[model samples]
Target: MNHHKITSDHLQKKAYVYVRQSTLGQVLHHQESTDRQYALKDKALTLGWNEKEIRTLDRDLGMSGAQSEKREDFKTLLADVSLGEVGAVLALEASRLARSNTDWHRLIELCSLTGTLILDEDGVYDPADFNDGLLLGIKGTMSAAELHFLRGRLQGGKRNKAERGELRFPLPVGLCWDEAGGIVLDPDQEVQGAVWMVFRLFQETGSAYGVAHQFAAKGLKFPKRAYGGVWDGKLIWGHLTDSRVLSILKNPAYAGVYAFGRFRCVKEILQDGQIRQRVRKMPRDSWLVEIQNHHEGYTTWNEYLANQDQLERNRTQRPENILPQAAREGLALLQGLLVCGKCGRRLTVRYQGNGGIYPIYECNWRKREGRSKRSCMFLSCPPLDQAVAERVLAAVSPEQLQLALAAQDELLARDGSLRRQWEMRLQRAQYEADLAQRRYEQVDPDHRLVAASLEARWNKALAQVDEVRRQMEEFCRQQTRTFTEQQRQQILGLANDFPRLWRESATSAKDKKRMLRLLLEDITVERGADREVQLHVRWTGGACEDLTVTLPARIQDRLRYPAERIDEIRRLATEHTDAQIAALLNKRGQRSSRGKRFTGKMIGWIRYKHRIPAVELKRPDERTVAEVASRFGVSHGVVYYWIDRNILPARQQAANRPHWITLTDAKARELQDWVQSSKRIAKRSLKRQSA
Candidate 1:
């Protein structure tokens, strides 16, 4: 070791010993490396720096030398070096100072400016000297390269192991690595049951929240395996959350697949401009390695894929996917099933009547896109809902549908409120307590410390057993009602009569929605006339059908006169006066739909609405179509054809209404001439000519 560069000025200032390890595992097992770093204090003393001048910056002991962001001691060392307070920076190696070139070079520049000396196990160097500064620069560059290579090699090996399905990472709760180094379902049956329950619930409910809610509602606990500290490899029971359920559903390990590179390490800049490394989840398609059927698992890969699709549909924020969402409480029976035929977008439901009781299916795509001032259409919901619901119920017999509870009353193969989990939990506690007691009994009294520790462990284990028993008692107490055989029989009977069960007040709208989804895939609605809607229904069995439904009229339309009455008034007004029409209506015992008696004023109002003229006022030469046909000795069809072609002079009040034909004796003779001249004019002409 050379100390020729160490001057009195350098020996007078404080000496900093920078110590760091890349990880906590290295700090615990690599004690020799830590001892070597601290031994630099002795080197500083031998270099003529007194013990007081030697400051050990070992606070960075379990931290990385890659960057100085999280290492307080490293930052302090840099601060002291920049301020010329550090006469010498002693570390076991240049890498200890920094494995990042930027940090290392910055330290070198500061050391050169302060005229400080850099010391390591190799020797001492004056940063102010040209040759020494060059050597320090090369060493800093080499140290950075070494760190990069080291990381690459480690990561490469890890990826290699993962590709072969041999890599060992922390398994998700329901899985664990066995002594033989193969992935297997956790040996704890209780944990297995809980995990199975989550998958089962999600499958039945088609919702992550539904699974979690089932757990909470049943007063059940979920299992989590502790990864580190004293609780490592121990089962942790806690309340299940939707997020936990989602993790379980999403984990491929549960599906018996080994996957690696699910997450990538990324360096992020914080608000304070400090660099920190974090992990970001990668998409499944971006995963580096995947091995299916790696071991026995809770589910299959196909089921996992289905679960993923179900989750994607259930996720609220997935705007790209317009798949039907989980059934919710609403009056709109076709909530997610209705698609706008015009705009080809999902139609949303809007409630507008008093207390929002009336639901209207509205297509707000145009409005949402700022393309329209109002929604595209607002089809009344009740008519459509009832129409489709009746058809759906009628398509199949009562035996086809089986109304089911959203969640089973008993969880995990009907284990009854996690009774199996509690019993298993208590058994494990008792086993541990018994084992600890045996260990204490075997230990000699002379070794009081060992015996006392064993005794304490036994007592703690017994206490845990007691706690488990108490929790089980409380859970049992909370469950007041048990599902009975008669009740089960009633449910079966309802299944036989599905419509009655579906119409029951106890059946929720959400459940009904679920029931509807099972039979029907989707319904495309096209708004037709103001009084009707066209429905294009697609069933799950791949059959398609189109139906038209009559919509309920508006308040005003409902109060208006019936079409039959209007037609009757139009017929009577052509020849009869309003007074005469009223008299005839009364004589016939006819009245308004509202039970009002016929009156002249009412007859006049009906005439005005229908554009009916009173007493077909015509010249003496004019006659009705029937009269014109009779005068021509031809059929009314011939007279109508002549009127349509303007051949015969006629006057029509409106389309499809009565027309009055003008007939002079000369014009009637001309029409008779055409009927006698044309072969096609008479229906019996062909048969009569042949005879």
Candidate 2:
């Protein structure tokens, strides 16, 4: 009846039809193809299959068949064929089922083993036969090749359009295409203002988060383009997010540049055996096409590149690769800019003391990472901060005159604006009062009912006028009281007295930090011996300076001994003992150069170190037997014998003092004869003792 293989068994089993499209765009625009595939159910019914035996798998209609795992309908069709349940599989074309040979041939192999028939617009064939299997394999391969050729042709056309910067896509917020086929800024003034404000605030604050915060603080909202739904192509206002601000800043379209292939779709296989598509942002240099000055933009291309560089530098957590981040509000001057010289890691700041008045910088990255904490450096905040601040001020001092003049102009403008605002309020109040009076006057006195209410309204308007006038007077008075000529002169003189301006209480820490960040890129600190710290500062313009600063003296600072004190101790050791010398030093309110109270043992140690002997002192005219023996070149016993025999006159100044020997010239002559006689007597006694 038909040149198609069909049997009772095939008729008893269900027939399945699989349908798919490469993209949702195709499914929407090529409805004829989808209808043709879906109409395969009628074909199956006409092939002796009941309505209950006919099945259609259309879940993959808008999904690509490049990878079968992503097409659940294709998987279900293959499952039925492999289980020998599907009698026949039908599609408008073989490519509609699968565009991959690996998937298409696998389906054919399963259908062949299950004795199922494959059908398409061409014809129906039983894949179980060798001839049918060979023919279907060729068809499957040709279908896969056709799919590739179609995709290649489409991609070639897209790339050609992109190369000429003519490919159209959804534009970012604040940009639109006109009827003349030219790019222009969003016609909505509010949208343009919001976009421009984001760039301006980023330039001032140097941070995306800062821009978002400023808008939030000002109670302003940013507009985004509504892409779909009832409000499509309309402006939707919402709070500005950091990511949104960053995206606006990073987009080169804001710089009037036509860029293509900024991002590409990447396919990844999931753990659950499905393919997922992700969008990856390509590097700027890797973009396929870029055409500057192709549209109206808020900034120049060079400015756009600068903004990108700034955003890259703002990554404080990645300090190892880029420069430090902009300053944040904190007590410490160098917050994100401090790097540990020892560990080459960023230092963390911790606020200590009551109310966090004292900030301490510590490099404890290793400790936090469960590594060794032995190589950390610690530094107090104030001394190091003051050193860096002085350096910064010195560097910027040459510009202080210009800065002061600018400040004066800014202040004058601000005051003028305030006065103008107050004047406007006063004028408005006066106009209201005048209007109320006119309305009251227009009502005749005979109309007392309307006159009474109008009179009350006039009185209220007059009261408001008076209140505004009073407020204006108070504002003027306060303005006059605030800035005197002397104060103005002081502000002008800040060029010569920058320290005063820098230390003024009116200067916020945040402002100071911002100033520092403008000049300094980073500061590497290393601890040195004797409470000294060395700072290696990298400036914004690639210049570096090393500064060595001594830490502030504390109550617990170690000190050294003074040379004068040591000499005095040595001289005193000759006359006084260790204890006496220590007592004398303590009495004189002298302390060890180390700031410690000296003791007898300390004095002894000093004496031993200086090689100064301890000499017991005597009265000015008093001497001991040892002294006399040393003076006369005689033994101490001989002197003792002379003193016992009273040959020499001796007297003691006090019991503790040594004996005083008055050996005058006459006594010296007599002592010499006595000594000669003692020698002869000693010789005779020695002879007798020998016998």
Candidate 3:
């Protein structure tokens, strides 16, 4: 290989000038680009090169030298040098040519192979010179190390500042850095006013999308983009919908707690061949810092929390398409009132199919389980046009209104009483608990007598406290029950008006199901044979009553009789324990007025039907005979005598076995009759009076 000896005179012979700035922050004027160009030209001339032969590389603005292969200007200049079109390469310094060791060495190797000379303001360094090349290598390594160190130092400083909560980034609107210098409220009232408007708008509209559209239509200018771009819907909506932006509005940070490090960014390589950034919330304990009274807050914490709850509710409610016009009008009243009868969940309204004509109110729980399961519950979707309007009209009736007012008053009074009672009981319980605690604390563990006494007292006090709390709860329920009848009347009045409203109201207005929900609780339709449909109307507050006021007398009669006969059978069953009496009645087979069979359920129903006196029943597991006797209001001797005498009926006697009874035939017959009659066969009535 024939190598040529390249010198400064052979290199400074290019015409092009390549100027570069590493970043937008680095101004070409500050670095004196013109001066550097002139100087490099002069140096080339000094090296016996003409001005026309001089070439300057200065087109690398907004470029970094971290990767030399990607620097377009550098690559072009190298190409010219390789073609021997350039005599020498001139720069202000070696660092300007390359800030990386690898790129520096590669340049040197190219220069040496292509017989190109390199010159800087400091000195001309020919690649052919062994000592000069070694010096250039050392300078290149130092340059690279300095760049690395600068980056490391910068990052370390940022991390330290962040840990101290002093690190500042872009303020996400509704906020500004403190004038004295920390995170603070924006001084511009206009911006703060806009923030307030966003919250108010959300509350009024009950929709983020609606609010965004309103702002867009009004041509509201979003906060000036920090990046110097015009704001569009994305920016406007982002500010309006951002959780952090809302957080700031709610945060006391404005009232002056500087909360920091609540979230962190994690970087990961995604399948799309790009690095993605994800944010994860940090725990409260891990928060970087919280300095109170940091700045003026735009809203109070309470107002902010309220706004958040409103936003959350809006998110959970039906979409615009699903919400009827009427519902939209009375949304406030019906927002959380309607509930599913089956799953005890809220029923959500939805529009089905393309035309959006098939409006339906469905239980989300049932829908999620699919159509088959939907039938398991009484699904009620009375047409929005008639049913809803009628229901609402009924709900707002004078009678209903009166009942509602009465119920509200009653409820308040009851609640007040309950609250007072609960407070009194709670105070007593707390006092007792305190006393027990103190006693427990005072008792020495080593002293059995003291410990035992304390334990017993503590147990007794706790038991009493529990009992009082239970009583308080029961009392509260009773207070609520006191208003139930009134609530029912109000509900009935509301439901009764629905049919009228359905007939008179406009179809468009009828689309408002939510309005119906405000007035009526539920309207269920049951399909029967012969194309007969039964409508059951349950008012908002009352027990469900069949609204089919014109039910066939026969059906009405049937319903009335089933319940009545069931009750009658239960009464008779309780009076008689005699299976024979039951059998005789079965043999006689007298049909109920409804012509339904009277079975064991009817005969023995009284045992389960009527509330038994607590004193009459023995607790299942009472081991002590005295306890059992006391529970039944019987003497212990009587209990023992019953056990020993086995005076139990034949069936019960069989259970007691040979140890208890030696029954004569006459005694057996008497016991049998008692069992049949469910009455004690009186000894006086018996022909043979044998003990």
Candidate 4:
């Protein structure tokens, strides 16, 4: 019969062997795989099993056994066991099958249902026995706990290392791992050169996207990924544009200092299958560890910081992809640098009509839908542009530079004098303070001396000292004058070179913005008749005075009003009763320059010019006779009689009276003549009465 050979009295059984590795560090040996099959086959043959019934599973190399669901051979083995295809299963250890309690329990359940026996190096386990099942469960539980404990211990060790600033993970781009230390520079300087090139390119193009595109087009390889390695725009741009990675280029850590735990994260899971909250960075002081001069550096700290500052300025001034073509052509030097003087808003360039012939800069904010209140008082003046450029160049010219350098020297000398004066004043104040303290200590406690006397004297001395200190501070502030003659010469050289440099050199939008700020102080544009325009340009050097155009009659009237009259108008407006005076003027056929009638709004304009505070007036009935007399410089009885007779006009009576009477030399002589004439008339009248 084709029955199995039964040497011993027990039934022979077929068994399968399964092997696995949990981590990349572990390797499967050919001998191990072959030996496992032979051992299981030998044991089965010894039990009188057929050779063909022996099956081995060894293809699942380097696969983890932590989760049964992920193990292919384990799943197949369980299925075969459940179908009763195998009577027994064998392995080197229980952990080799599964280190998770849940997975182990599932295996045990399958074995018991299929009546399959499990044999390990320790002993054979009969799943049918209650005691054996319990022992197996306990072993599985211990194994899983051991795995968890091992993981916890490993993580704890890593955290401790991080606290000591010795933790090492995968090195980021522009850095490499060192066997002696932890992270260091790449042995090849080519990568570092490339990194510098990237920074320089960013400083030139002002766009990370453009930089990445350029790099990719040039066939430069990006840093390799940890998994599935390939270079693409996203990866290239991600590394090139990452603020974190860029920060590393500017970080002092690689200069031989340890910096660790610069970031923290709060763990949170969202219902949408995403991690909502994570990796919140903390302050630098809160970092876990810090050590100075940790490794070799690719760039100096100053250069790195400068690059970072430049990058930030670029981010603010140049939006990504907005000026890609302009960047490529090196045009649009004034793209982000120009601003409208009238509206104090940024100006953007526009190309209109066919062939884009007309290029004009217009204020974006001034062109809003409802911005018709003022018909763009700002004018576009090309002469203003040329004038500004010329003035800037002239201001930085050799002679001008010499002047600036001289000015700087004068400022330095002034600063030194001021500093000495400040020191002297500070010393004097300290001495005074000390004297006050000593005097207070020397005073007799029993004497009935007024404390106010001492306080007054101390306050007076302190006030004097404070005055001197304030003068010194003001002197110091003034000491920050412009460059000296030599410095001005150097700056002039730079300024003279700027136009050419800006034209030829590859400068970023940020650089252009800085240049504009340094060179041009302000640009004022005025619209003339027939759409003609005039520009007033101001530059950094006080040498280039602001252009003063002959203003229109309307504007000139506002500017040239007599100071005294303006003050009077402001004072009257503040009295609030000036509204009646304004109404009187309106009634008298007088009107404002715009031919508009007077209103309360005009009061504000008048008051603002006069720099006077507004005041409320009392009701007419509340005006006392004394108060009316005081206002008009008349006797109370006279004021009352006038009020009773109603001789004076209501507006004149309500108006503020002059504080003091004044008579010029001519007016005084005229008054004397009038008095003499009146006396002669009086004498003639007396003679007639006598007759």
Count of backbone clashes for each model? 0, 0, 33, 19
- The TM-scores, one per candidate, come to 0.60, 0.63, 0.40, 0.41
RMSD of each: 20.1, 20.2, 29.1, 27.8
lDDT of 4 by residue, 350-428 (tens): 6664987545555545446466554355323244445455656566567776676677778787888879878887888
TM-score of predicted model 3? 0.40
**Local distance difference test, each candidate:** 0.83, 0.82, 0.58, 0.60
Residue 309 lDDT (model 1): 84
Candidate 4 wrong stretches, greater than 4 Å? 1-14, 23-25, 28-38, 44-49, 67-70, 78-87, 106-117, 123-134, 152-292, 300-484, 489-691
- Runs with alpha carbons beyond 4 Å of true place in candidate 2: 1-8, 22-29, 112-115, 125-134, 317-319, 340-380, 394-494, 527-532, 550-691
Best by lDDT: 1
lDDT by residue for model 3 (1-691), tens = 1114444446445643445556756654456754675466665565566677766676676676665655778989877767767656777666677787777898888877766667666666778679878987888888788889988899788768766667786655767666556666566787777777776676555556656666777776556435454533123333343444345444445544566777887767768644456898776577767665545666565565565555555455442222212234322233333454445555465555597644455555645667454532322234323433454565567776677678778778878976897888788897997899798988778999888888888888888888888888877666654446766676566555655655555643423444454445554545455434444556656767553322234445554435654554455544454343346566777554456655544444433545421112223432355543443344456446655666632223123222222345675465455534643323322322342
What is the per-residue lDDT of model 1 for residues 1-691, given as tens digits with 9 covering 90 to 100? 3367777888789999888888889999999999898898988888799999999888887777888888898888888888889899998989888999989988889999999889888888888889999999999999999989999999999999999998899999888888989998778888889999998998888899999999999999998788889999888899999999888988999999999988899999899988989999999999999899989889999899999888886765432455677887897888888878877777777898689898888888778779888887888887888888888767654343332331334332454647777888889988998999899999999999998899899999999989999998887776435557687567556555778768889999899999998888788888788677899999986779998999877877766888887888888887887778899999999886467888888888888877877776667767899887665566688788898898989986545557888777787677777877887765544454556
TM-score top scorer = 2
Q: Model 2 over residues 580-634: C-alpha lDDT tens digits?
A: 7888998899888576778878887777776777665555765678877655556
Candidate order by decreasing lDDT? 1, 2, 4, 3
